[model samples]
Target: MRIGILGTGNMADALATHWARAGHQVVVGGRDLAKARRLADRIGHRTGAGDLRTAAEHAEVALLAVPFGAAAALAGTLRDALAGRTLIDCTNPVGPGFRLLTAHGPSAAEQVAAAAPEALVVKAFNLCHENVWRMDPPVFDGRPLAVPLCTDHPAALALASHLTRDLGCTPLAAGPLGNAALLEATAALFITLWVGQHADAQAVAPPLSHAAGPA
Candidate 1:
């Protein structure tokens, strides 16, 4: 798979490393060409660097790793280049106090979709810190990390799921794009618990057997 990463930040670097190592072609792009080149160099072989539009136009899948505040505008700018492409949105619009910045409006994913109407927008990878993604396979307690994805497009879902597995993580189908707000809100709550409360957010949920009643 050819993957385009639209940022030179931590998430972009972390996720692209896994994909590139898995034999996928990767293009790291950013507003600053030098930063993109540096990131590509750090990722080593099979990865290249380019401008944002060039990256978006060169790949079948594009990952938007830009800041949440800038994502919509960036998506609008790349609308034509991203048409009919699967765009992965890993942004979390959490403000101070770990509140959902988009509390009263569409989710970060929705805003990106509205900006690039022709693109298949998928919400994923927003639930964990980039450091967690940097872990080799992100396993904990003997279980591989589980990624929940929300997307309306079948192909987009499949691609996201494949990438999750590429990192040795399980992908949980969290429903369609309409449910993305739920995912974003969940992220906000989990971040608050993880950071402010210094709690293990995972403990807030019961095991599947328990949640499924007397199964």
Candidate 2:
């Protein structure tokens, strides 16, 4: 996969490095060329670096790792470059109190899609910390990390699934793009439980078999 990462932040660093290590061609792009170059250097493995548009045009699959507040505008501006490409939206719209910033509006993924109407947008990778993504395989308790994806495009879903498996994680089809708000809201709740309440967010649910009461 030729992966373009549109940010120079922790999530970009964490996930891009893994894909690059897995033999995928990676280009890191940011508003600041120097930051993008620095991130590329850190990712190593002959990773590419450039300004945002350059990276956008170089990708078969693009990861929108930019801040949630800036993503829609950036996507709108890069609409032409992103057309026909599979766009993975990993941003969480959580405010200072771990609040769901989108509230009753469209989810962040939907906003990005609306901004870049021609892009095949997929919502994924927003459920975990950057450090968890940095893990070599992210397996825990004998189970591989399961990544839930929401996308209306089949090709976009496949691309996202491939990337998830590249990190040795399972990709689950959560639903189409319409359900993205649910995923974003879930992220907010999990963050609140994990950080604000200092609780194990994973413990909030029972295993699959026990989800609807005893079998």
Say which candidate scores most in lDDT: 2
Candidate 2, residues 6-25, lDDT tens digits: the string is: 99999999999999999999
lDDT of 1 at 130: 97
Residue range 55-126, candidate 1, lDDT tens digits = 999879999999999999999999999999999999999998898999999999999999999999999999
The 0-to-1 C-alpha lDDT of every candidate, in the order given, reads 0.95, 0.96
User: In angstroms, how far off is 30's CA in candidate 2?
Assistant: 0.8
lDDT of 1: 0.95
Residue 62 displacement (Å), model 2 = 0.3
Task: List where candidate 2 sits over 4 angstroms from the true fold.
Answer: none
Could you tell me every candidate's TM-score relative to the true structure? 0.98, 0.98
